[model samples]
Every structure is written in structure tokens, then in C-alpha cells.
Target: LSMPKGYAMLGRGILTIEGVLTFCSPQLNFVQMLEDHAFGAMIKDFDALKEFRQIGNRLLGALSKSMDIPSEIADVLKMTVRGQTKINLGITEAAEPLNAVNKMVDKLVIGIIDAALLISSSLICTTDMSPKIFEIPVLGMMGYFAALVVGIWLLNGIIRKK
Candidate 1:
């Protein structure tokens, strides 16, 4: 027996799903790459700073034990180390807000991708003649709107850079 036209429709639906993923893949990749690079750099810097602090503390301890350094001088050095430790704590505290911002960005990007998938699936599922014609304009309008928003965001970033 021959297959019905619905079989072809099923194939088209699969293609649409693939296209949606293809469209969003680059954006997801870019976000992941940027996040990885940023986290890598931050971790590298934090580790370097931590190692330096440890080395300095060891050196100071050695000096206090071996040299005839006065107690008052040692006390001042201890206070300095305490202050630096507090500063490092403050940096960590400040990072909480940055982490929140990163989470928000992740949610926003996921929302955009979900919206795109929803729109594409809706377009694919509409089998009627009239609605399918109407959907094309709506889809085009949405595409234009998204492009406009992205352009504005890019412009804002460029302006802020200068």
C-alpha cells in the first residue's frame, strides 16, 4: 500500500525541528564558550592570588622565627595580612551579585530559545490552508522584531565599550 500525504508532513515536521536546533546551536555555543573563558580566567587569577598569599604567609612566618624581628613589627605584619584576608573576603562577597547576573543571563537566553522552538513548532503544526498563510507574516514579523532587539543590544554594548 502507498503511504498517505501525512507521511510527508511528518518528514517536514522533523525537518522543522532540525532547523530550529540548527538556528539555536550557534547562539548556545557562543554563550557556552564565553562562559567557559570567563570562568577559566577568574579561576586562574583566584588560584594565583591564593598561592601568592600562602607563599607570603610562609615567608613571614619564617622571618619571624629565624630573624630578630621585633614583636611590634610582627604584629603590624599580622594586621596587614588580616586586612588583606578581609579584602579577599570582600571580593568573594562581591562575586555573589555577578553570579546572580550570570544566572539571569542564562535564563534569558533559554527563554529566547524556548520561544523560538515554540514558534517554529506552532508553524509546523498548523495544517490548515488559511492559517498557514497567516502564520508566515506573523513569523516574519517576529523574526524582524528579534533582529531589531538584538541590533539594539549590540549597539548598546558597543556604545558602552567606548
Candidate 2:
């Protein structure tokens, strides 16, 4: 597809994802949108407001990307007003990072549950293990595994922090 047309499609998709994010967790997603000024005004907590400002700065840096919105490839998007073009491009470009963030959030929820289960199973198996069962112990094994995961995640967090 042409660059402009592709951008239009991507822009609409971004807005759709934004709507979904708002529906799922409005508070967390308040600053996700490129032009999410309303969220900034709504937050009352000082920490939340500060976080929103940081998000705003990140978005401002990203929005500097001047993308070409797709026009005449035959679609509903080509009809967007010139004034809304920047918002459209900003939203579309932001969609990628937003989508990745959403995916990571989902994975984290699932991972937490899974890790808990593994740790629980390990504890149960180790606590209940008899001398007859000479295999490696359970709880400690799971603990090691969980610790490794946490370590990796923490390392990644540090990398991102840098």
C-alpha cells in the first residue's frame, strides 16, 4: 500500500486500540493517547500528575515524527480534515508502542499467576516429598526458576530505565 494510505489505515487502527485501552483501564491508559490532554487535567494526585507529565514528554518526542497520512487509496480515512491530520498521525505512530505495552501488561498478569502456581506446586511437592522419591526437590526448584524469571525481568527493567 502507498505510504499515505497505509498511514490512514494505521491511524484508524491506533484510535481503535486507544478506545480499547480506555475501556479496559482508563486510569492506566489516560496518558497513552498522543493528545491526551483531558487526562492530564483530570488527574489530581501529585504523583499521577508527575507520571502523566513524563508520559507527555515521551509522546511529544515521538509525535515529532511527521508521518504522511494515506489519502486516495479509496477508504474512509482519506476524508479526514487537515486539522486532524497530526493527531491522526500521532495516534497511528503511537499505536505500535502502545500495543507493545498492552501486550507486556497482559503477559505480566499471566506470568504472575503462572509463577505463583509454579511456586505453590514446588512447595507442595517438596513439603510432601518422602525419602522414596529421590528426584530433585520441588519447592526449591520452583523457587530457583521463579527467581530466575524475576531476575531477568528486573534486568530488563533496569535496561529500560537506562
Candidate 3:
């Protein structure tokens, strides 16, 4: 496809995705919290969306290659392609807000841990301890940060699991 045509297609896809995200934003959080069985159903829906995208892409490619195709026929084909593309785009757009929410939740969890660390550090400082034992607080802080990183990684894995 020509660059202009491809960009136009992308623009339409983005707009459609934006509309879908707006429409579904309210329910996104609830959907994320679903049990594994229900989440499997959601994954099926995502797979269907991916299939629609693939079909749309194939239709567009086929239409582009057939020079002898009538304009009327081409128009119909383009419409179908764009429609399917929009559905796929919408699904992708809907996922963005959910990702943002997950990041926010992860940050909140980390913040709570930080608060606890601060409280514990203050309590530890009040005690008279050997210099060697003082190393424990520094190590504890390092371990807590390491745990934060690992926890976020695991959470992302859980979220992305099929």
C-alpha cells in the first residue's frame, strides 16, 4: 500500500480504538479482577479480535493486489476491511487503560511497602545496636526494593498469562 493510504488506515484504526476505549473504560477495572475461568472467556474475545484484525489485513492486501477489481467491489471490500480493523483497534485501545490501572496498582503496593519500611527504620534507629548490626537496616531496604521489582514483574506475568 502507498504510504498515504497506510497512514489513513492507521488514523481510522486509532480513532476507532479511541472510541472503544471510551465506551469500555468504566468496566475495565472490574474485568481485570475476574477469576481465571472468566478471564479465559475474555482471552477468547481477544483472540476473536485478533482474528478480525488478521482477516481485515488479508482483505486489504488482496484488494490492493487485484488491479482489475471494479471500484464498486473495491469500495465494499474496503468497508469490510475497515470495519474489522476498527474492532481489532478497539480491543487494543481498551487494553491501554487497563495497563495503566495495573501500573497504578503496582505503584500503590510499592508505596505501602515504602511506608512500612520508613516506620520500621525509625523503630530500628531508636535501639542501640553494634555497627555490624546497623548493616541489617541497609540490607533490609535493599531487599525490600528488590522485592518490589520482583513483585511487579510477577504481577505483570500474572496479568499477561493466558
Instruction: Quantify all predictions' global Cα lDDT against the true fold.
Output: 0.66, 0.65, 0.67
Error of 3 at 141 (Å): 8.9
Q: How many clashes would you count in candidate 2? A: 3
TM-scores of the models, in the order given? 0.23, 0.28, 0.26
Residues 40-119, model 1: lDDT tens digits: 98887787777899999999999888776587678778988788433433455777899878866865785676567556
Clash number for candidate 3: 0
| TM-score of candidate 1 relative to the true fold | 0.23
RMSD of each: 29.5, 26.2, 25.0
The residue pairs found clashing in candidate 3 are none
Can you write out model 2's per-residue Cα lDDT over 36-134, one digit (the tens) per residue? Answer: 675666664358767899999988877665232233432345445433333433455787899889877876776687577667756666664643235
Considering every candidate listed, which one attains the maximal TM-score?
2
Clashes of 1: 0
- Measured by TM-score, how close is model 2 to the native structure? 0.28
For model 3, state the Cα shift of residue 46 in Å: 49
Clash-forming residue pairs, model 1: none
